[model samples]
Target: MSLQTWLVSLFLLICVILCWSVSAQAFAPYPYDSYYSGARFRRGPLMGFDGEDTQLQQLMQNLKPRPTLLIRIASSLGCIAHIHMATAGEIVEVNWLAEHINDPHVKVLDATYEVKPKPNWEEFKNTSYGKFDELIKTHVNPNYTAEHIPNAVHFNLDVAYFPGQYERFSFYSPELFEQYVQKLGINKDDKLIVYSRGPAAGMLFAARVWWTFKVYGHRNIEVLNGGFNAWKSSGHPTESGDKSATQGNWKAGPIDKSLYANFDDLTNDPRGGNLFENKMSAINMLDARPGGQFNGSEPLGFPAPKATGSHIAGAKNVPLPNVVGETGVKDKSALEEALKKAGFDASKSTVTMCNSGVQASMLALGLARLGIKARVYNGSMSELALRASEYINSK
Candidate 1:
């Protein structure tokens, strides 16, 4: 055959191979499909993900680190809010929520944070720098003292997300996150809803609580759209003062760190090897903040030390859009396509991180629909800003 003919044939052959590969992957079995329809929403790479081995690993492993203490807070069998999505949720919102805002078992907690002037400087401590607006102005609960929604308890987000310069922000060890949850009279079995001021910060905060419950195997959680602002806009009442209630033996479950990404984990591990690189095809990162913040050009919050770094090492930048009428993460086809070209397979792993973890939640939700195995790093820019030198010296 002539050279020209051979070249044409080779190109066609490559096309045929590509088509077959994608077809085979499409037909691959999904055992979880028996339960999770949401799985279909993912947009993963056909070439990279090795779910079969991982799935088998899941089956072969019967070992649970803290099986003895774990409880399913929301189960298909139990969690009230989860079971009655429309009806019970409505009734609970009306009859139970307002009256029980002061309930011993239901605690409506607010997890808020403020950025420090320097990345490593701690916040919410005894300092002139710890103003609430600098933490996250949009999600503040000003109404909590005025007339808090019923069946709620108030706690500073610091109770869970306290940060230190020497270490990644300290989380309420599973034990700590759990104890605080239970101290508010919350349990594995109660219906729970977490709200924020706007969807980004609030959703991120709510995701932390939701993740805490889920990692402990508690599933009955929902994030209120638009947080306290939405609540008040909807005419809900807010109250003031910290309300404490009876506690329960809310045991901590095995720490499932798999659902979240840690700064150290992203920086060192092979799974997160692509973390700081811009080649999306390597499964790097996606920033959820406005472009300026991610680019290290804008001040993170009014009182926050200006953001530094070119975002999470190597991740591509895609500012969350101001979707009309929708405040949460919106479906953006263009952004999704960009991610695909960059090697960010929704079926594979990606860590959504922001200054304080709240904005990342918006990115996580958007990625979730695309079938990406995404986890929130939980620390926002503050995590890096506080520890700027560590990243600066290395990169």
Candidate 2:
């Protein structure tokens, strides 16, 4: 009764202890290297067998899980990193604006401008003087100023450039931009909501402002979907006269080079010949001009009155209207489908171009909302046609 029972009990206890030890090691967070499956580790002194270092193991254990909505961006070296993408929530709707209009932290900007026939001092003066006033009074509403959007300040695109260089749509100088920043009273933390007269107009004006703010390092900027026309059509009230903004402490931050492209960048490889023909280039040049303009069937406007029109050789034509509808930018699935049909590869880096930089910026913004990074060629065809005439001139 005593010896046989004691031997059997002792053996069972030993077997159970061994099984528990194996199971605990299998599920333990520290020892096993399987957790770093997709991660690539560099050879360093801190690395252990299978590249799992004690410090790294401790750090991983202490780190909290990433949010589901957060996107993980990998570096060129294939290391996981984090970056923010502009979401649909970043885009303000008319109803949201109506509710938040009076919020002190929310600043509204009316980015409306009439397309001038030519770039001359007289035209500029006339347009600036009573033309804008009449536009607000007549075209917009008698009770409102040409820059009407109810408690909104006007951001004149005309103010973006230095006085004499009217032909080129150059950004205002740093000093000038600083003054304009103060005039807008935008702080680092303030939320900016920009709108234009109509959808198409907003794409040109409001989106441009949105890009400018992003370039200057402002983070909380948004474009009003459907724009002011939608706002008015929704029967919202309008305000008359111009409203001035208080001085803000905002200063220009580092320019986001990824968001802009110039002629030199476009013409980097002389052997590549045309801007679009550079296969070695990382960027895909997208012509956002109208079909007629892209196909050389239309005339170049104003400044280059006699220059025949054509797109950069090898560029894919993706009309701006196709990406934007009556409301705002189309939904992601629709945009992806349209872009695919237009031969745009979302996987490749993209550079958007149009007659002027405005439409190009709109397309860039649209791409950004889709989590695709893009650059805008601000000079676009207007400057390109004049500079790279050999490439754009029709035979």
Candidate 3:
């Protein structure tokens, strides 16, 4: 072949390969026909060609790459980012939160609380320090109140509790929530950031507050990634003694009942209902307790149960540690995998419960990160065992 002919052939081959590669990347899966249809082709020439050759070459060169594979996959599966969860860095990224700390529109809440078995004051005293103390002070004395993140207001988880009842902890009523809103000086449109002590302790407390805000129609809210533990570990400044927030006008909106689950929802009836027999296929129950508790072995120091053995019938045990690690809730992919392995169905409704409904919020928070709306059973096993006679060992 002549040298000129050989050069021309090589140029055409290169163009063909480029065009093929571009085409392959642009084609997305089903239900995106509109995406493909709306894509436009640019008119231009390739290798300085003209007329028919120019037209063909232009078509090849004009083929643009489509949205990235991640975007396409997200679109195909109808994936959405959950706005309710935030990482430690995300809150502090570029000093975003630091800059806004003094802003009237930004409010930070410390939702730390002490959770120990009932009738065990010693256990409560032992468990309340460390992460819990750093986030918020549950008790006050002349010596000191608990330390907390700077400029953070307090939201006592105790307000959500009602002891000696079938359902010990219930969602705070609108009137009570309004009192909180007024006390915290938060507006409906304000950006609220809540944090706890750790994944096992304060994180769940933070999640419960996050859930409460959501139930009351507060959309502008986020949970701190690793709570106060992560904040202190990062060497952020802290303050001791109680800090009062400026009073502001904040009102409660309509309640979103879907964010919470009561004892009746988890059982067939008020008295000794069988969880498995009454189970709704649409709703999956997830127990966020340790394996021992899930398998019917009560942990030492836990209150003697009115009825004990196993988790609620039909409950899937997904330990809190599996979803949250030393740093924080595991990355999104890891959390999704953990849930799937535990037989969680993203398409179905999920109800998370733990010993006293504290750790369960961590699991719910993890699910929320993946854009799954999970309802928290506030009373959880503590109330369930007392109210229901039936318990089954999943082991």
Candidate 4:
């Protein structure tokens, strides 16, 4: 054959091979070797193609990659950057609150409530720091005066509800909430920072108070991230006495319906209440109850007439301990991972429910840190068990 013809044939063959290889890489299932392939595309190699080709790179830049699992779940779930920016004012770190503790307009509150089985006081008697009887009466029972942040008032969740409400810790009526905070000397304009004793349940309790304040239309409210433990561990000053203050005019603002969810919302939900089986729900109904309780293997252990062992029909168990870690709410990545592991769809709206709405608030707080706004089912499993027993799912 002639030299010119042979050269043209060889060049055409090489070009065809290159095109085929590019097509295969571009369409192959993305491996983890390079960032351009898997979840988010970076416009470089298709699947770890080491060689740089301007045509291939430009083609990739124009090609749309498949959305990540989380992105496919929901675009409204928000991203990590959005999460960090959004979480700034909702929770105060220990140092920030310490610096502002003395500010007059800032009101710090110890919203501590015990949800565990009663501790045997006799065991702590000898190892106690001071007079055993006095300690048990004042400190052990959270209802009374106790050690707290300096200038911080005690917010007793036990009696925060209206007289005729379902039970203790049921959401308070607007008028009753107004009277409750007024008695604590909180004014409408006060910038409230609520904290609790433990990182898990305590933080949840504090979040519940924060949620309540938000529900009543209090604009300037936040939770102390790590609560009392964070404060004490950081060497922040704490006093062992009740805070005394004259009443300030705190009126209940119009209720913010968006933050609170009722039983009917659950029944009307599109998730159809069983993410555990179907895994394709428009709403992520999270049950913050422990695994045993969720599966009906363990009792709720509370005296309330609430159903002990079951969850709302469409809920997935995420548990309180998983939501709140040793350092308050888990970091955004960790929380997202935990929720994802529980079959959470990042793009869907979330409604959190627990035994008494406590852990739900905790999960809400964690979701808040992730920049995902979630509603709390204030009439949580307690109301569900009593009113909508049909929706309760037992293993």
Candidate 5:
């Protein structure tokens, strides 16, 4: 790990031990749309690490993470996820998932989260099915009604992983997650393939769900590259049926900590905050918002008073609009070249932060597909903007 990362991890340990009593804020819920353009977000207190227990930590060690600046353990909801740095996972090619479309035992999950809220209720009930075929039949959107992934289960990454205020988008309670997986008839043995509508919206939902499985101890989950768009773009087959997939006896295992970000490292550590200031060298803060926003074109209600940072001093700007225009960032060669030409190291870690965590997820996903090491700063631009006040003056 870099010197900044080491110090941050150690400092985070101190923060968690000394201040482990605050409640976690709600995650930006799915159907995760409400991008209040000019919305300003403040960094909350440390998100905390559930390191009092070592069961999860052991699993993380098993992953054998390389010593890098991205290693962090995110703690929340009484559990800890050993979140590696951004751009770290095995990013399956956008078109790669389609190669195995004919596998019968391979189950596909459709994370269709709708906002069917009552008249004035700030919170709407989120209904996710373990099976996507059923959800397709109960189709709400005009686009999805046409066709859906066969034998796919409906996993609502939107509402299942919501926080308190953002309860609609926080992580699902362990009980709810297990019940949802079982309801979809997914067991430990079945390989799970997850897909969504588009790149940013859907792929992010897909990744969050993938992380969920790791938390629940399911090992064979994969995200369909480019989501439904990539499949259709390649003329892949699609089916619409209520054919329920059978569920195996899959017992929920302890959370594999590798998927979490250490709240301490994220908040209290010197490296965590210094990353905002390390724009000159050794660190790159990628902004996934449209160039308009990054260049100060205020869309919506953003450009917060504190969302100020030097774009990592010499950091290159890679707008999501360019990467995944219309469909998604499926072209691997193009993405790799983009980073190479931009002077980015695929093996080096990066922190993907967008308006919230969603767009960042897309960038992170794109980076991962190109084998670039990146991680989503789930706190969103709200957190980053707020944190930036310490460095740059937004006003």
Candidate 6:
């Protein structure tokens, strides 16, 4: 062979070796036994060249890539990078989930909790539990059983792991949260992609699931942008029937307090004087409800009893519809514009609340996309409406 051809071959070989090394490093298990994307391989026999590494064997068996030199190289470099950065952002594109849908390391969850309030809601104003019961039968259950993203697990958030004696919107206890996660077959290091279809084809309930994961110290999770509607619109695949997952060994870590705010934190904090009355204060309280509900012009939302259209007197109304676009959560630039138009003060500490905790999480997710972290009031207005008379009168 000519000397020039020989040199070219040497350069190509070096690139291949470097790419392989990077791929292995990208997949290697992190310290503290964390996961990188979903590739949590044991540290042994470089990429399992020894042929006895069970993890490597499983990986190879699971991924039946085309047997071509170029394909192998591309798979190593391109595909590994894709997996490595799968959960890097708060949002993942439909195309990315489509490409990695079959990877064992990637877990997709459908967190759809469709809310259907009655047309004449005042008749059942005091029966929030009945509304929830009705939605489970008519909306949430049927939607998941009828169609969902291929291989997506159903994350039943409303009542499955709920505490028995709290107001209906309470966060699950740490133990119950752990049990729920493990049952979903989630691993500590798994790349979780959560999606939901809103009443009008927007992304809604998934943000609460993402927030719950973050609250329990799991960071490798992303919301599927545009949600199930986006997947269908793009002509990706779907599954009609429910499927079971092998239970995962996933355990909950210590709660991350910064991501959560309880009722006491909102009511008693020295920095907060804004929950009961409209005032300029240290914290920015953004209510993710429509102007009508926030200002007492419309009927109460899903489960807020007694207080039809009543909100914390201090909250600036930043509706969920404004925070999320027609498809999903707005893109970064659009989100920033919306927040600005809604008079969101980025400098102040933010606490988001809606009727329940659901819409608040969507606002929190939008703030997160803009690199601003905000707390979700787990109790939200339901808790507030139930007990507001106690605090509102005292304050």
Residue runs of model 3 more than 4 Å from their true location after superposition: 1-95, 116-146, 199-202, 268-276, 279-282, 298-308, 392-394
Residues 30-137 of candidate 6 have per-residue lDDT tens digits of 431233335544543224234334555455444444234554576456534544464278988999999999999999999887554313233333443333334334
TM-score: model 6 vs. ground truth: 0.70
Candidate 1 all-Cα RMSD: 15.7
**Candidate 3 lDDT by residue in tens digits, 203-228:** 76787787777778876777777777
Residue 285's C-alpha lDDT in candidate 3?
86
Off by over 4 Å in 1: 1-107, 112-143, 166-168, 198-204, 237-241, 271-274, 277-281, 296-309, 322-344, 369-371, 379-381, 385-395
Scored by lDDT, model 2 comes in at 0.65
Q: Which scores better on lDDT, 3 or 5? A: 3
Ordered by TM-score, highest first, the candidates read: 6, 2, 3, 4, 1, 5
Q: Give the lDDT ranking, best first.
A: 6, 4, 2, 3, 5, 1
Q: What is each predicted model's overall lDDT from 0 to 1? A: 0.51, 0.65, 0.63, 0.67, 0.52, 0.69
lDDT of 4 by residue, 104-162 (tens): 89998888877653233344334532332333244434442557888888776544642
Tens digit per residue, CA lDDT, model 5, 248-291 = 55567764443333223444434435443444244455667666
Q: What is the TM-score of each candidate against the true structure?
A: 0.58, 0.68, 0.66, 0.65, 0.57, 0.70
- The deviation in Å at residue 269 for candidate 1 is 2.4
Model 1 per-residue lDDT at 366? 55
lDDT of 6: 0.69
Cα lDDT for residue 244, candidate 4: 72
Task: State in Å the error of residue 233, model 2.
Answer: 1.8
Q: For candidate 1, what is the lDDT?
A: 0.51
Return the top candidate by TM-score. Answer: 6
